[model samples]
Target chain A: MITFMQISKRYGTIRAVDDVSLVVQPGELLALVGPNGAGKTTLLRLLLGLIAPSGGTASVAGYDVQHNGAAARRQLGYLPQRAVLYGNLSVAENLAFLAALHALPLQRVADVIALMQLDAVAQRPARTLSGGTAQRLGLAQALLADPPALVLDEPTVSLDPQSVASFKQLLRTLQGRGKTILLSSHILGDVQELADRVAILHAGRLIAIDSIPALAQRCSLPEQIHVVLAAVSGDEPELLARAGAEAHLDGDTLQVQVPLARKPAVIQALLHAGLPIRDLRSSSPSLEAIFMHLVGQAQH
Target chain B: MFRHTIIIARRELTEAVRSRWVLLCGGLFALLALALAFVGMRSVGLNGVAGFSRTAIALLNLVLYLVPLLALLLSISSMAAEREEGALEVLLAQPIARRTVVFGKWMGLAAALAIALCGGFGSAGLVIAVAGGDTSAGDYLLLVVRSFGLGLAFISLGLWLACSSSSRLRALTWGLLLWFSSVLLYDLLVVGATALFGGSALMTMLGLLLMANPVDLVRVAALIQLGGADSFGLTAQALIGFLRGLRGSALLVLALLAWIIVPLFGAVRAFGRRDFTA
Candidate 1:
């Protein structure tokens, strides 16, 4: 539903987005993860046609963003990072204006307001709402037109935990409805929980793009083996350490970071040690670890 | 495209109305018009100044000083504030063209200012008519309409400045300087120039100079219509002689229309070309 083809945006000497190409297929929930100055926002703005690309092209629903910006944007529901609304207008009024801009029926405003659960303060001025409420209002406006594609830039940045959970739930529902979503976020947990695929951008370039497990496999990060012993044993941590694992003893629990290929051998070694095992669990590398490993590798 | 533009325009208008900008500006104009009309009537001993032409002429000076300045400040501040508050970015992300955004804002603001001008001066004109005064309703209506044109010209200039400026502070600085040059300093500079260099070229230079400033163009247009050109001293008489009668008025109207079109076009162009990243 969305594609960025060799897109590059430059500000004099600074290349904000450098020859990046990405695509979000129909009903695919793609999360864009990067640190600050990673050009995630720039990439999204390029697709929105808010800023022209220095090179290459971007398209939404097969319409070139530069030449057919209005048509391209018609297929997109954008939630900006700041999500600022007109302070003087009420929540409902703001959404209604957006609906009118999209040429949607006024009924969409009411529907979105209800969907975002903004009924409690629908008539209140946007400026008076809390950060979470305002974020919800921003989401409501984006969802007002019922566009098939969504571009959400850090949609949950300012939300409380409860609101973030609800927002994630909303994203899941939208995904269930077959909306192609491209969301840029700093929260790896949210991305891990919702995204079907993750695109890692580092220093204006997309370094990696794949599913979490695939990325982990490609990065070859170590998996963590956690063992809770029934009793603490002297020299047990030493024995695990000698087996080429980064082993640490925390009270009665033994935690070891080992390569994925050596997990079976490590488990056999721990079993032959004759330690009473209260609990044994082997966990794959987390998305955060994979992200850090990827970004760290790119830095080197 | 037209629908999107109108929708954005309607939003701008609704925001102005909800924020009481319309009421505030309307009330201010009405109060000033009433006060000026009553004062002019008293000064003319209730005889000559009771007519609509005379009151409109009296209000003309006020409009020249107030309308352009108010329009510049209002339009510039609104644009600057929207841009600073990031509301403009939100609007631009919509499925609308950049030109539509600029034109919509201009139309909405122009409409609001028109309502205020009519309500304010229109009510004052009605008061003079109700009091059995010798009022030329047509002439009075013409004055109000021209004042609206003047407002639109300034609004367009203001939007041009707002669109080009990088920040609210910069927009305000440029707006104030433009307002000062056109409203307060343009006449002084013209008078000084004509006095220092008195020749056949002076009339042509003066005509071009007047056209350069929409405020002066509006003032000259309104004064000539009110038949008060002679009161503005030798320059007005000289201008009237050089350009002839009807042609001069038409030229001033044309100049005013250009003032509205050229700057608005520049604004639309600037808005369409600039990046909204910041």
Candidate 2:
């Protein structure tokens, strides 16, 4: 259980995180989405107790981040935006160092290395690894102690497609294991697939926090149905103007915004008026459109 | 805390021993000691080989300058590099106090320096004995112990600089500048100030200030080791007397403890409030 209440962080004149209040329930996967400088990193840091919040409180596993920082840290794992590990040490050595820090059993170090697929490069110096590999190593280090709550910011950003898929699968598995995960990413597709709920942040404010379906329902536009009439040509406008039919020509396709409840009546009127309907298609606003709408509204 | 310190110390010692520069420096010191020992044997004949004076002077001179330099090189950029690379944030996120991290790292680096100095001087002593050099066992032991004290002082000073800066280059520059000032310029200034004032109060202030500088304390102790403590000015004598009162293992431990404790405390305090994001 992660709780952030009335949190605000200021850097000089900029309010990096502004009056943000959020709760991540047990086993919940919360996705944080925002544009650049939208307080995603600051909020993560504040929750980790690495930086003090300008006001309010952040607690992890019932430990107040400010007053019981060590206790809170014991129950939390963090991956910073920039991972700077020891350059001279090998992957295994770095893992061992971190494991020693948390007083984890020695065997867990090897176990984490294998779980992160770092076995092949376990003996390699950290300085030699690529960006993606380094990021995975960072993740592996964070997971070594196996804390119940996780805050991963852009966990799959640097990974290849296969790696991203595997990582997403792993996240699903973790969710099933009852982990509270707060994953931050700019990509909506991942959020659409993985997140149980999402918190949209814009310019340091929490604009929306709800399930994708609910968010889509709230921000969704009205459905539009388009019926393309077969070529019975001129003077057909009067026929198409029958009751319950609101028709407009859009290139070759005739567009009609019909209530789903009134669809049968409109079709019956169109057929009775002798207007041949060549093809009919319904266009409903997708989650992408809803996200854009909400983000746009919040930006204002 | 002890476990953490030991874990850190082991890693630091392993890394320091594997460095090519440490090997090179150790080799050079051994060669220099061997050459000096051979010369001593030829000059003073057999009876002088058992005396404490030559070995004590050599160890004192070598440790006074080199230990601090090595300590500065090894540690001045340690925490700063970690900060630059963002590793400090990861480490701090663990269930450990910031001061614990600082102290553990300092202890680790200090352990490495102690080993390097003691090992280097021990090898030097072996070479001198092989060349039939004029140094008794008691004198050799004294020099080795003094080197440990000097090494502790330097390591602590390096840790102080490392904790203060966010950039390695800045830390290195500052560490070097301070080391140079404390070692070379501080005593000169004190002597000049005392001469200019010519009053007992001014003289005592100058005396206290000079004694406060670790390098001066080491230099005075070394002169005492070489039987010249009484030959200096009144202030220098007083400083040597103060150090001698704490002498043998007791004084050695105390001076080294002061060196280790003061800057270490400051480093820990500074680290507590540092913006680790840097």
Candidate 3:
């Protein structure tokens, strides 16, 4: 339910977000992953209408952000990279104020407070909250209106492991409830686990956007087959090449890089070639590996 | 829109109150006013203008000097910190108009500053009344109003600076420089102009100069209202002679208001168009 069409933002000579277009369908969890200065935050801000685009338009549920920003933002719940509440105001007060912005009832604030499990510190000033609690307070504010869409920028940056796990669970629940979630993050594991699709940005451009397997396949990334052979073999590379694979030999083991579809054939070919495979293990590339390959390729 | 503005405004005011920003500034102002009242009585024994008029006159320069700096630093630092710390980004991401955020912040800050100024001066006014000195409540109230007007003007300027600057330090630096020029350099320039010019031309030039700075404008207005026009220097007296009537009072209020409204309008525009990206 979120859309950006040819949206570009320029800071003098620098193109912060360059002619980028994206869409987040309802109930889908899309993760934006990028390095520093990769335009993730800029894209989010442009969609929030905190900054006007130099060219093109962004909309939420078909309401143009620039022209009807209030209405558009009404459908969005945004948690910034650094979720700052008024330091001097208590957690409940902060959530209540945000709720009032959407004309939501005080009951909504209480609901989010419970939803985020901030009941203990409800009366404490946000300045006194720990990083995880503070982040939870920020999440509480974002969820105050029960919005159908959430745009979170780096929501798990500094959270403790427990909090991060809880946050991931919450996202899953929200996704099940059909809330459109578009989160920007640097953590590959979270993206791998939570995202339905990943959008990789590199130097102000969308470099790749697809499911992990789809992206890995499109990039032709090599999965691995590790074989602890009975002894060191000199002809392993040539033998693996015959089976449409590449092999790197180290002592008594061979690491063969091949697609998952060809893994069984390669292993069978190794057997046919009279190579001794004492033990074998197969693995696929992680999201991080895929991310690096994509970003590294874009840089080239 | 109004509802959202009020909600934002209330949150800001709550922050100000909870932070003890109100208590600290209000207590300081009251202490300063009481000290001024006590000193003015002793000083008045020699000059023959007793009680509230003397205290009001003594408080005029103090208000013009201190209030603008206080308001500028408070509003500028508050706005700058909010933006620098990412609070503004969060707030603006909500379903509220940009202009509403700016206006709401300005109003909340304005109310807090007014409370402090009035509470401070009111306590001192009470002391003077209880002491059986000559008391003119109108004169003292007039001084408070002038102080608030001058402060409102500076607060507007501070918000504009905060909206336009890139960092908190940069915004605060701009705030301090603006306060210095308006509170210090502008007066010196006017004095130099008076020395360089002559006759009827000098009178018009000095009048414009007095109106050019909010501090000087409030000073002239206070001097005229307290019936102490003859007490100032020739430049101030000349402007006083030109602006000592109902029309002049209206002009002063209107000009002071323009000082307040224009910068606030600029702040709203600047904030509305600004990017919240670091």
Worst 10 residues of 3 chain A by lDDT: A95-104
**What is the fnat value (0 to 1) for candidate 1?**
0.82
Give stretches of model 2 more than 4 Å off.
A82-84, A220-295, B18-25, B35-52, B55-59, B133-135, B238-243, B246-256
Which candidate comes out best when scored by DockQ? 1
**What's the TM-score of chain A alone for every prediction?**
0.95, 0.81, 0.89
Q: For every model in order, what is the iRMS? A: 1.3, 2.0, 1.0
Native contacts, share recovered per candidate: 0.82, 0.61, 0.88
Best of the two (2, 3) by lDDT: 3
In candidate 3, list every pair of residues with a backbone clash.
Answer: none
Cα RMSD for candidates in order: 2.1, 4.7, 3.0
* Rank list by TM-score: 1, 3, 2
Instruction: Summarize candidate 1's per-residue lDDT along B1-278 as a digit string, tens digits.
Output: 78877877888888888888888888888787677767877886774336776667777877888888889888898888998888888888888889998999998998889888888877777777877465568777888898899999999999999999988899889989998888898889998878876656777788888889888887777666677776665755888765557777778778889999999999999988988885
lDDT tens digits, residue span A8-65, model 1: 9999999999999988999999999999999999999899888999999999989999
Q: Which candidate is the best by TM-score?
A: 1
Candidate 2: pairs in clash: B49-B134, B246-B251
TM-score of each: 0.95, 0.84, 0.92
Residue pairs with clashing backbones, model 1: none
